[model samples]
Target: MSFTGTLDKCKACDKTVYFVDLLSVDGITYHKACFRCSHCKGTLAMSSYSSMDGVLYCKPHFEQLFKESGNFSKNFQTSKIFN
Candidate 1:
């Protein structure tokens, strides 16, 4: 998908940052370079991945992110958000 490439609010820096890249995996839209750590909510290292796509995470955040991203909760719970 094509991205407009703009400044987005960083969850860590809490300020507008220019997105330098994009991730296409999650299919969710956010500033390409603005993704936050799925655990501690910090920034993920760009060097951690060979390519930027979908949901990527820093080493420490991957496990939880993986579960959540995969909708592991679907097996045990329900939320109005999904309805």
Candidate 2:
């Protein structure tokens, strides 16, 4: 069965909420902006994880992309394909 949840936006900011999945366990959800990097305080971003592939991350963190890209349009085409 497929799991589903709301893509809640943060009240403080417009970033989407992200869910983290742990191995063979119920996942945890957190506001994408609510937590910051331990070292740089950069807003946390979710990366796809795999036992072999591991978690992926940009060097400067995800928030930097939000700023630099200056574009926040959701990909309706991509999202619709999933639905």
Best by TM-score: 1
- lDDT by residue for model 1 over 1-83, one digit each (tens)? 88654554544335554545444333343455566654355655546531123334565445444455673221212343643
lDDT of each prediction vs. the true structure?
0.45, 0.37
Candidate 1 ranges beyond 4 A from true positions = 1-29, 49-55, 63-83
RMSD of each: 9.6, 15.6
Encode model 2's per-residue lDDT on 22-44: one tens digit a residue.
Answer: 11211433454444443244554
Top-lDDT structure, candidate number: 1
Give the Å shift of residue 20 in candidate 2: 16
Clashes of each: 5, 0
lDDT for predicted candidate 1 compared with the true structure: 0.45
